[model samples]
Structures are given as structure tokens and as C-alpha cells.
Target: MAAWGQRLAGVRGVLLDISGVLFDGAEGSGVPIAGSVEAVARLKRSRLKVRFCTNESQKSLGDLVELLQQLGFDISEGEVTAPAPATCLILKERGLRPYLLISDGIRSEFDQIDTSNPNCVVIADAGESFSYQNMNKAFQVLMELENPVLISLGKGRYYKETSGLMLDVGAYVKALEYACGIEAEVVGKPSPEYFKSALQEMGLEAHQAQ
Candidate 1:
């Protein structure tokens, strides 16, 4: 415990995962975990800087923030780093027009991007939108492209929600990858760059947070 404390002494920032840690996914009626709100408040009061990082793509950033606030979390839209926004930045930077296979809630994030004549596919947690027809359509687009590009918001296999374990975007992404013989570029959790970007936003170095 002493050695662990010594190592943590250098920590200056905290990156909190929104789902599972704070609450269980359930659209607008998400249930918060016991003490998570108070824990977040304590973290905010501490010397360490805090940032909410999530792979949530089914809802807009504003909506997500509003939900958290309603659950008594003192969160702001700016302090949260979600996959949809990050994916948007990447789409703009690469100038790739994507045929989005994402939820309608967060579609506004890519409003500025051109979806006409899509050269790539951006798949996220589309919830019920991940229909057989939609998947086949995305597969067709990728197969037709000379250079198929698949951008996955996150690669989580599954996540626990209020009801039970629910399928995440990774499963669908892998299916497309297998069919198209192409790998997807993951832009959310488990991506080192994503964590780095969150830490950078908190004005801290990699060594300062774990």
C-alpha cells in the first residue's frame, strides 16, 4: 500500500469512464451507481483535475451531460471526451466522407461533414439501427470502395447496462472487417491516442495520470 501511494503521489489528473463506472446505460433513464455522484464531487474538489471519458455514441454530448446533471453529477459538456466528437475531428482531418452507421442522437456532431458520395464507413453504437439491411448496406459500400476505410467509435465487445450485458459496436465492426477483409480504425477507449488526448485536455503529461 505504501509503494502504491508513492507511485500515485505524482498523479495530477483523473480520467473517469462514464459508463459502468458512473451509471448503467438506459437512454434517458440511466441508473447511477451507488456513491458515484458523490465520488465525482469529491474528485472535483481534490487537487487533481478530472475529465469524463466515454465510448457513448447513442446520445449527443449535450444530452449525455444533461442526463448526468439530472443524476446529480456536476459535469459539463466541455469536460467530457466522447467518441463521437473525437471521430468527428478525425473525419474532418482526413477529409473522408463517411456513410455513418451511428445513432441518430449523435448525428448532429457530424452535421458539417459531407455524407454524399461516401468513401468510408463510420460505425458506432447505433442501438436498434444496426439492422440486417443497414449492415449489408455498409458492407456493400466498403466492398465497392477501391480503398475501404472503416472507422469504429470503440472496440468494446460488450458492456453491462441496467438490464444486462448488451452488445457494443465492436461486434458489428468485426463482422464488417471479416466481410470486407479490412481492419477498423478504433477512435475510443483502449486507444492510447484517445487517452493521451484526454490527458492533454486536462493539461497533464502521460506520467501524471494512469
Candidate 2:
């Protein structure tokens, strides 16, 4: 297997994370870090495949793409990837249909949302729509279902700058877990499958991007 830094550093296709790598998160504002927009544009001009990946539970691939473009970074829908899409796959495999409590963007990935089912696959993206109503519903579903899957797109205060780390999916996920008394099944980053999918899309083998 190839180490990620080694192989990726030399590849034509480079997958960049939006919040930290491209933009500082503490800026809260949607725009990317100052030079990031231009830096990404320059990479594109070099004929490299650049995919901006984010754990943002709020925006969808299409939405992020548009935002990036407006912020001066050139990108497309197919060039972006989010954990919600992967969460959809995990839910399907479990044969569990969730009364999904998510943003319109997250909900858009699913074919249907069964409101009655107590079982839920919580997908937290820290998006703008994340609210009390949504959290309450998710808690209720977790309380009802003995074991609900809480697939975190990624954990941490992804956005950062000069100040310090901020609250992120981990905080929300932990709060829900404590309130519901049911542990969640997280499926995201450091999850080999997620990395595998990213690598595969870039036309590289698993070890190739180790």
C-alpha cells in the first residue's frame, strides 16, 4: 500500500478538504481562505483533478460547488463528495430505513424519508439548518430505536483560524448519545471505505493512496 501523502503528493488528481486546507473555518463566512480560491484555480490550470471534499452536513455537492465557484474556485458537482451519500449506502446495507432528520441537502440524497420509523441514521453536517427541532427528533428516534446509526461525515471543528477550535458534529453527536441512552454507529472518516471510494474515483488503487 502506498502512503497517502506520498502518492497523493505526486498525483495529477488531488482531493482537498475545503474547511481547513482550502479555507479557515473560524471565518464562519462561506467564502474560502483568501489565497485558497486562487490557489485552487491555479491547480486546475495545471490540468490536475481537484476534488474539494467536506464533511459539511449542511450543503450538498451541487450547493458546495456553486458556492466555491462564487468564491472564485472552479469546481463541479461530480468533483465533490460528502458523507451523506455514503451514509445512504450504509443505511441501505443495514436494511434500516431512517426517519431522516437532516437538512434539505442531506435529505435530497435519499430516495424517501419514512417519518414513522423510529430507527434513524443520524447524519450531522453542521449545516445552517441544524436546529433544536431536528436534534429533538433525532433524540426521539434514538430513544425509540435501541441502536441507531449515527454516521458522522467527519468529526472535529473542521473550520479553523486564529481563534481556536469550535463545536462540531462530535459535540452534537455526544449530546444525542447521552440523552438517548443508545449508542450510535459512526461511519465516516478514518473509515477505510470512505477513503477507498475517494481513491477509486481518482482512478488510484487503495494502497496507491495509503
Reference-based lDDT, each prediction: 0.92, 0.65
- Measured by TM-score, the strongest candidate is 1
Model 1: CA > 4 A from native: none
Where model 2 places Cα greater than 4 Å from the true spot, the runs are 1-12, 24-29, 111-115, 126-133, 158-166, 180-183, 206-210
Model 1 per-residue lDDT at 34: 96
Clashing pairs in 2: 2-207, 3-210, 4-210, 25-159, 25-160, 57-125
Give each model a TM-score.
0.97, 0.76
* Tens digit per residue, CA lDDT, model 1, 72-189: 8999999999988898888889999999998888899889889999999999999889999999999999999999999999998998877788899999999999999999999998
> What is the TM-score (0 to 1) of candidate 1?
0.97
All models, RMSD in angstroms: 1.0, 4.3
Query: How high is the lDDT of residue 54 in model 2?
Result: 65
What does candidate 2 score on TM?
0.76
